[model samples]
Target: MNAPLLEVQQVSRSFGDVRALDGVSLTIAENEFFALLGPSGCGKTTLLRSIAGFEHPDGGAVLLGGSDLLALPPNKRPVNLMFQSYALFPHLSVAANIGYGLKREKLPKAEIAQRVDEVLETVGLTAMAKRRPAQLSGGQRQRVALARAIVKRPRLLLLDEPLSALDRKVRAEMQLELKRLQHEVGITFVVVTHDQEEAMSMADRIAVLAGGRVQQVATPLELYRNPANLFVADFIGTSNLLPGPSAGQHLVVRPEDVRLVAPGAGRLDGTVADTQFQGGTSTVAVDVPGQAKPFLVTEHGATEAVRGTPVGLAWQHEVAVGEGLA
Candidate 1:
């Protein structure tokens, strides 16, 4: 196999007393859309900053194209970071904002203008070039920031919470845009996000982080289907984690995998605590006798089960599907 485009080798960092990145290490392939996913305070942002040269790790090294990346400063490194806020200059026009980095690089006036126009067209904002950041919509502002980052044509682009500022609808739209932009430009993207759905929807592969360590690194489906441990199983999506036959292990059954049946028909029986209608799917929370948390069962369209209804839950046997990843 070919070498990775970016390699993070046992990178470690810490705050005054708290360890932020505990020997974290991962790799990214060329032109891959990769995500660092975890909850707040999980060291994902710290790791991204470290890779961008904004933060230095006490130990270990970061390599870009097999060259030492830590030896350079943020500006000197061949990378650009897009802030969560989109960080567009309010006073500058969209065109100026996109070309700001090029100006600093002392590129010729004509070349900067040409490159800025090319990027504006690439991001589909050619018509809004004259508008200021404040005049643009949230999505437009995000595009300007993206255009600015890519205008420099860096080897790797780091985006910190790129779409967190957009509303649900706009965010959904921009997710596809980001993927399209990445593929069109063929630039390696490393995005940091706490949103699981965002990471799952966009990234080719994700590195799930927790308490400064990598839990598992795999494609979204692989991570969902074969979680490395209880944390990964519970974090990626919903998992009905009941005790397995062996001690200290769990039978990780997904809600979609669960089949609802009459009380006497299933391997386990439960009382329907509640049913939540979510557009095309209904999430039925079932309270089983031995389990502390309700077993969530996903039913397509509308569910027939109501509160207080007794139901049985059965899923495909482990042998029929595949053994849970540990």
Candidate 2:
């Protein structure tokens, strides 16, 4: 709708013989929180870098707000990148770091100070304005980095694994903070991350990439519940991949969807191979006859079966079947 705020058309990149990105294309609407998610080396970072003008694509165009970004330098484009490392000037105070971009633009001192103060308050770091990077905690440092990026009032913000360095609890807090900041500022945020949970919890839409190609793009729930292909189903979360003939090919089903019934109650019988207790949930591995690998079943109820117990396994036909890939 409204002509996407950012359009990436047939983007491709290569280094020597290795193709890092292959004919990838996507559109990001204004004020959308878009995430590029995949395993390491899947080209998510390359795509973000291409948008930020750090990496030039071998083929394709990156357009921002209908303007060709390829024709401009990184600074010339209305984009700011908040690097993963925080990239704070350790030597500069919090205010100084936040005002770094404004200083480079040669804005008047009063204006730079006013904008810096506003952003510091917006990120809730006004109390630590005099502190340097070394004086702040991990979360504070992250906010400083964010304030620095948003101070320039760019049309788009690029984040490259911005929360990967923080501890789990702090990372979770920052996720909500980032979302709130985005809503308050109303700027488009495109983040590149390999952490599935991070992307699932934060993004409005996720683009799953594999081997330099985009596998699927959808809302978090849509991607999780109705994956387009096998790679996406396995990557987004824990699942049981059962190998069976379907239209002369293989099919998969989720572990939670597979039910364990009394022996002789279902079509298949399996011996309980192992059990793992994870607080409130349990995962039971069942070894079925004629199958090389065990089938994993995740149940929320307390453990009822012990190892070596014979059980019947069944799944709804709809859950057991996945669309066959070509």
Candidate 3:
């Protein structure tokens, strides 16, 4: 097998009382879009910072292409970090801001300009090259930051909550844009994000972290279908965990998997407590007598379920077994 482009071997970090990263280890392939996903204070950011040389690990080593990345200073490392804020200079034009790093390197002005223009076109910001940060939209500014990072041609690009600054619509747009840019630049992108959907939409592989430990590392579909443990099943998406046939066993079922049937027709029966219309789909909350929480069912298109209506909840038993969850 080819060696991984980036290897984080048993990396750990602590902040006085708290262990921010506890023996976390993972690898990223060349030109891969990777994501470190977790809730706030879950060490995803800490791990990202460690890779970018902002934080030194207390143990283990970080390797980039078989070389020790920890031994190099932040600037000396072949990596660029894009902050959530985009950090574009308000006074500098988009072209100038994108070329700032090259200028600092004392590269010839023509070379810097050529690289800046190429990256601007790559990011679809060539038309806005003359505009200052203040004149650009939030999404445009994010593009500027991305263009600046890629203009340096770093081996690895680290993004800290890259889409958190945009509004919902813009965030959605940028999610696809990010994936496109990663492919276009062919750079290994390691993004740290608390948003599960964002990671699912953008990452080629996702490392779900919790309590300073990596819970699971898999593709979005694999992680969603075959969660390594209960935490992963619960965290990745909405799962209806029900009592299994055996003692002390539970089966994880997705809302979409739960089918509504006639009375006495399925494994469980419940009463519809509420129905939520969500554009293309609807969520029906069913109150099963024995279950502590209401069981949710996702239905395609519009659904009408009057409150207190009796409903039967059924799902394919083999689905759980197929996923190795049973």
Residue 303 lDDT in candidate 2? 73
lDDT over C-alpha atoms for residue 284 of model 2? 91
lDDT of each: 0.91, 0.89, 0.91
Residue 231, model 1: lDDT of: 87
Q: Kindly indicate the candidate among 1 and 2 with the higher lDDT.
A: 1
TM-score of each: 0.97, 0.92, 0.96
Ranking, lDDT, top scorer first: 1, 3, 2
Q: CA lDDT of 84 in candidate 1?
A: 92
lDDT of 3 by residue, 181-243 (tens): 999988999999989999999999999999999998999999998888777887888988877
lDDT of 1: 0.91
**Better by TM-score, candidate 2 or 1:** 1
Clashing pairs in 1: none
Tens-digit lDDT track of model 1 for 22-116: 99999899999999999999999999999998899999999999999999989999999999988788899999999999999999999999999
